[model samples]
Target: MGRTKPPRLDGESEDDYYMRLIQKLANEKLALFARYQMEQQQEEEERKEVATNLLSLKKSKKSSLKRKQRDFDEDDVIDIKIKNKKKKKVGVTTTNKAEQRPVVVNKVTEGVKEFIKNKMKGSDLKLLIQKTLYASDLNPGQNRLNMPANQLETNANDFLTADEMRKLTDKDKKSGLEVDKDKKSGVEVGILGPNLRMYDRMLELKIWDMPCTKNYVLISNWYNFVKEHYNFLKKGTLIQVWAFRLNEQLCLALVCPDHEDDNVAFEENLHDGENDDVAVAASASEV
Candidate 1:
C-alpha cells in the first residue's frame, strides 16, 4: 500500500461536479435577478420625482423692467444651412436678402410616444438613445450625444406646456405672414394645434429662454408651426446633459441655428448664387 493514503477520492464523481455547477449557476441567476429588481425600483422612484417637478412649475405674474439680453446680438445674421452639400452650393443662403423664413418639422415614432406615456426621465432617456445611436454608430457631434443642433433644441422643447405653446406662438402670428394659401415651393410648417392660436405662448418662451433675438422669427415659426400641441416633459436638455452627463449626452445638446452666426453671413450674393441653380435644376427635373 502506497503511503499516498486513501488517494484523493480518485476523481470527483461526474454527477457531484455537475450538481455543484448547477448550484453555482442558480446563485448567479438569483443575484442578477435581484440586481434587475433593484434597478427597476430605483427608476420608478426617479419617474415619480420627474412628474412632481414638472407639475409644480408655475409662472407667477410679476412686473418686468429690464429685459434679458438675447444670445444673438443686434448685428448677428441668421443663415440657412441645408444638410446636403450639393444643396449647400445651391440652396443654402448667406445674405439676409430673399426674406428667409424658418421651417419646422416634428415626428416621433409610435413606439417612442408610447414609452413616454408610461413615465420616463433623463437617465432612462439616456439609455434609450444610447441603445439607438450605438446600433446606428452615429455621433451627433459636439451637441449632446452627437445629435443635430436643431434636434437638440427640439428635444429640449419637449418640456413646453400648453400655456407655453400659446405664449411662444403669439409672436409668429404677429410677425409672419398668414399665407392662407401656401406658395408652390415656400416655407412649410407643421405645428401643435390646427389653429394659429397656440403660437403666442411659444413666442414668449423662445423670445426669452432660447437666447437668440436677432435671428428672424424662423426659429419661432419652426418650433410653433411644427407641433400639434406641446406637452410638458421634464427631462434634462441637451445643454443640461452636456453639463451633467460629463458630456456623454453631447449628441443631444449640439444645435445649429437655422443660419450662420451673426458675424459670418454665408455671402448669399458672393457668387451669382445657387438659388438660380436650384430653380434651373428643379425645372429640368420636372420636365
Candidate 2:
C-alpha cells in the first residue's frame, strides 16, 4: 500500500469526490478552520444574548427614572397651586380688614338740647328747666319754699340717678324719648311711682284712640287736675306720656290717662287687664 489513505466519504457523488485528493492534502488545516468558524458563531450568539439583557435592564432603569421624574413634577405643580391659593386667601382677608371702618355714635343729649332750644324760643321755659334739674336742695330748712320738684318728691331712689340721667339724655338726641333701642318700637311707655308729685313741671292731657293709636289733646295741667279729681289718677290706670329734655334733666311734656272715648271718668281698675276670677265666680253663684 502506498501510504494508507484516509477512507472516502460513503456514497460520495461525483461532485463530492471530484476534489478528494486536494481535500485530503489540506484536511488537517480545513478541520482547524471549521472549528474556528463554529467557535466564532457561538461567541456571536453569547454576545447578542448579553447585549439584549443589558439593553432591557437599561430601558427599565430609564422608564423608572422617567416615572419618578413625572411624579416629582406633578407634586411640584400641586405644591405651587396650594401656595397660590393661600396667598389669595390672605390677600382677601387683608383687603376686607382695610375696607372695614368704625361707626360713629352721636351723643343723645346734644339733639334734645337743640330741639328744646328750637321749640321753646319765645318762653323763658329753658331757664326754668335748667333750674329745676340742677337745683340741689339737700338742706330742707334753707329756702324750703323755692325748692326743686326733685327735692319735694321724697322717693328720689325711684327716679333716674345723675349718671343714668346722663346716659338717657345721650341715648337719642333727635327724640327726647328714652326709647327701647332693642325693640325699635315708636311708642315708648314707662311707669311712675305713686308718690310722684308734679308741682312746677309742664303737663298736658293726651287722649288715646285704641282703634287708631292717635293722640288727641284733651286738656293741660293734667297732674294738677289729678289732685282735684283724685279718682282720675287711679291705681293701674294706663297713661300716655311725651318725654322731653328740660335743661340737663329728663322731663315729661304731657301725661294723661289712656281712653277709648271722651267719657273720661277714672276709677280704680284691675292691674294689666287681668280679670278678677273671684268676682266672676261670685257672680255665677248669684245667677
Candidate 3:
C-alpha cells in the first residue's frame, strides 16, 4: 500500500480518527455548495431562455397583427359588396308571423271574480297584487302584510282616489303634525279570506316610504286576519289579492289558486244558507 495504514482504534478518540472525521464533514459541505451553485446557474440559464422566447413570441404576434389587418381590409371590401346584395333582397324577404298560442284562463281567478260579483256585490274588482308570501308576511310578531310597490299588478295610483293618494304621499309626518285616526295616511280596507268571506275587522293599507325602499303594507288587524287564515297563508304560498268596492267601502279578496275547491264548497254553503257554523266561528275569532 502507499505507506502502512494506521492501526484501527477500538473507539474514535485517536487524533488520526478525529482528523479523518473532520475532513469527511468538510468535503460533504463543499459538495453541497457545489450543487447549490449548479442549481442557481441552471435557473439563470432557464430565465434567459424564457425571456428570449417571450421576445420572439411578441415579434411573431406583431407580424400576425399586420397580416390580420391586411386580411380585415380585404374582408371589408367583400362585406360592402355583401351588404349591397342584402339591401336589394331586403324588401323581397317576407317575415314569418309568430305562432299564436291559446290563452289559458285560470279557473281560480275566474271564480274570484264570480264571488265578488255574486257574494260581495263588489264593483271595480281588479287584481291588485299577485305574489308569493314569505316569512315576513306570515310572521306573527311582524303583524303586517307587505306589498312592494313594484309587485302591484297595476299602477298603485289607479287603486286610490286623488285625495287618498295625496294623503299617502304627503310628507307631513316629518313636521310632527298631529294626525287624526280617520285622517291617517292609510286606507282602511276590509280583508277577505280565500273562502271569499270578509274578516271581522279592517286592515290599514299604508305606504312605508324610506330612503332607499318603499312598500305598501297592511297593518292594524293584520295579525287577526293572519291568525284566522294561518293555514292557507304560509310562506311560498301563491296568492292573488283582488281589490273591489263593497257598499262603497274598499275591500280586498285573498284568493289561493290551490284552494279553489274549498272556495267552491264555501260558496255553495253560503248560497244554501247553511254557513251559520262559519259565521259563529268567525264571531269567536273576534273575541
Find the candidate with the highest TM-score and give its number.
Answer: 3
TM-score of each: 0.18, 0.17, 0.54
Clashing pairs in 3: none
Candidate 2 local lDDT, 33-150, one digit each (tens): 5334433433343344345444555566755355434343333543553455346531121111221222211222222233334532111222111111111111111111111222
lDDT of each residue in 38-86, candidate 1, tens digit only = 3343334334433433344322324353447753321231111212222
Worst window of 10 by summed lDDT in candidate 2: 128-137
Count of clashing residue pairs in every prediction:
56, 1, 0
Name the weakest run of 10 consecutive residues (lDDT summed) in model 3.
93-102
TM-score quality measure for candidate 1 = 0.18
The candidate, 2 or 3, that scores higher on TM-score is: 3
Identify the runs in model 3 with alpha carbons over 4 angstroms from their true place: 1-105, 173-184, 261-287
In terms of lDDT, the best-performing candidate is 3
